[model samples]
Target chain A: MAVQITTQEAVKKIRDKSSVMIGGFLGAAVPLKMIDEIATAGIKELTVISIGAGYRGGGVDIGKLVLNKQISKYVTSHVGTDPNLIKQIVNQEVELELSPMGTFVERIRAGGAGLGAVVTPVGMGTEVEEMAEKIIVDDKPYLLFKPIRADVAVIKAHRCDPLGNLQYKGMSNTSPVMATAADIVIVEVDEIVEVGAIACENIGTPGIFVDYIVKGHSYQERKNVYEELWIATNKL
Target chain B: MSRDYIAKRIAKEFRDGMYVNLGIGIPTESANYIPAGTEVFLQTENGGLMFGPKPERGESDPDLANAGAEPITMLPGGAVFDVATSFAMIRGGHIDMTVVGALEVDQAGSIASWKIPGKLLTGMGGAMDLLYGCKRVIVAMTHTDKHGNSKIRKRCTLPLTAAAVVDMIITDKAVFRVAEDGLYLEELAAAVTVAEIERLTEATIMNIGEWQESEMS
Candidate 1:
């Protein structure tokens, strides 16, 4: 079972220069509350591992950290959505490592499963192949990518039981893999229920993988964050 | 030609029961032109298989998005899985064809789509993987850039997504099939002339004069 904690306490687990895995696809299933707490704490020079850039541009979701200059390095599939991050990357202020979205997900999964490496034919003749080791299996060539694990993982879900069983609504993008690939896993959920509230069949992430659970901002509150951002940018 | 006309032409290449992957940009529009009663399964690299067209405004689900993060809907027998399984279908060569947009394509069919020097790019998402893994690679793009420069180059000056991998190029003005010799002009857009295509193109387009828009149903 996981203990219910405040977002501040959850943020404390992440220190400066720590490598963290964030679960989301453009803010859909990201841990915005914990991320906000970290940004407020002014932690600097962190390494962020994510699937894509934050949604709708700067000062929103993970883009806030990019705007704050808290992240020194980012490993992601794409950064087109955030112009701030793109400017930083262009200026060489922040180091960026690019990966295929599918390979990035599989590398994290390999980390959790205690696997040595993953071999795939996805980037055989591209620059991605140059970054990896090539091995031949049964006379077939494959690019071998190393496993990736983080010091902490912050994830989001629709519901979490007191035992930390997570149930996701729309789709579980990177949460399931990040949950198992980190040393400490913190989950932010919309609602918390009693044990067995989330049936075993419906649980996307089991309680055994969670270290801490936190109640995130309400739906309306979270909505207001982006709403205000849009108004401020005159996009609405 | 309009974007929809390009999509409709590309849609005709899809065979029933073919598992297809559509890349971002102009290739995403082909889903709207799929022939009715065809069982083509649209495989998205972001973990969606057999999805329908983009949803109506206000009906879009943030969670159910395509590779471009635009809201979409799932069709019958559609299943959503993690990224690993999605790429397994891709990298394992299970997909029949994939449609992608290119920044430039050389005469040898090498594609350069992800990056251009001196420009800030969003980085390659899954274009390289699709180019390397799919059985057939169909490139869909406008014939020229905004500056009116030819995109069909003798050699790609930009970083390549993949080399010698493209099977066919379908632009707004023409269709060229790659062969052992070089690019062969197989089809032309409606009312487009061979001389006009030659003037606008940087690569040497061989006119085999076989297929045309009128010959296509």
Candidate 2:
């Protein structure tokens, strides 16, 4: 059974220098309240694994961590969207390790499934091959990437039952896999319902993978957050 | 030639029922020009597939977004999944075509679009995987940089996204088909001359067929 916890309590589970997996693509499906709490807690030297840098501009979503200098290492597929994060990576302030987006997600899937590694030909003749071990099988060459497991995973979902069955409304992105690949999974959801409320078929993440649940902003509130940011950044 | 012209030309590559992935920047513009009455499903690495056009300002959904993180709408038959499944569709060669922006492309059909060494460090994102797995890979970019240096190069100076993966190159001034032998000029923008193209492009035009004049309107 997963216990309901406050966002502050959820952030307390993360420690300095911990390898943390943040589940989201850009700002969509991101755990904003939990990310804010983690930033306010001032945790430092984190090895943050995410799909990309935060939303397009700086100082939003996971970009807040970059502004706070909380991350020492970033394992991501892209950083071009966030200028602050790019500056950190360019200036040697944050060590950056990148994998092609497909390969990156496969590695996390492999971790969750208890696989040793994944081999693919996607990066055979590019700079990505330099970052991994090359193996040949039956005269065919492939790059092998090791699985990635994190100490804690922070994810967002649309709704959750009291027992922690998560249901996602739109793009789930990396949350489902991150929920399984971490030792402690903290999920932020917009609403909490009865244990039997979420149908089994609708459950995106089962309670077995979740450790704690934190209530997040409502749908309208979340929409307002992005709308305000978009207007402020002149993207609207 | 304008960016819209480049995108319009690239959009002709889409076949009915094709599942296409569009990379960020100019490649995203190709979606707006997808041929009328051609039902092509748009796939985004962020997890949505068969997504439609951008939503109106006040009608946007925070949860529904494209790979570029811009608000988007899903078609009637669209579906959403987790990131792992999304990439599986990409790496498993389920995507029919992909249009991407490039920093440089060489005579060998190799592309360099992800990095610029110490100056810029944007990671490859999904370009490498898309180029390697998609049935057809098309590059949509300007013919030259702002300094008038050709981006179609004899050899790319930047890091490679993938080698020998580009099937077609669509630029503001011309369209080139990448064959196993070499690059072949297949079309030219209106009012653009072969002499001008030869002077600007760094890569040798292996063969110039009876090239068609591209429609500007």
Which number leads on DockQ? 2
TM-score of each: 0.90, 0.97
Q: Scored by CA lDDT, what does every candidate get?
A: 0.82, 0.89
How is the predicted docking of candidate 2 categorized under the CAPRI scheme?
Answer: medium
Stretches of candidate 1 exceeding 4 Å from the true structure = A218-236, B56-58, B206-217
Record all residue pairs in model 2 with backbone atoms less than 3 Å apart, i.e. clashing: none
Pairs of residues at least 3 apart in sequence or in different chains that clash in candidate 1: none
Q: For all the models shown, what interface RMSD does each have?
A: 3.3, 1.2
**DockQ per candidate, 2 decimals:** 0.43, 0.76
Q: Which lDDT value does model 1 have at B88? A: 79
Tens digit of lDDT per residue, candidate 2, span B112-193?
Answer: 9988887878888888889999999999999999999999998899999999999899999999999998899988898888
| Candidate 1: tens digits of C-alpha lDDT, residues A1-236 | 89999998889999999999998777555788888898898888989998888875656789989989999999888888899999999989899988777788888999999999988877666677887899999999988989999999999887899888998766577888899999999999878988877789989889999999999976556545534543454433
The 10-residue segment with the lowest total lDDT in model 1 chain B: B208-217
Give one clash count per candidate, in the order shown: 0, 0
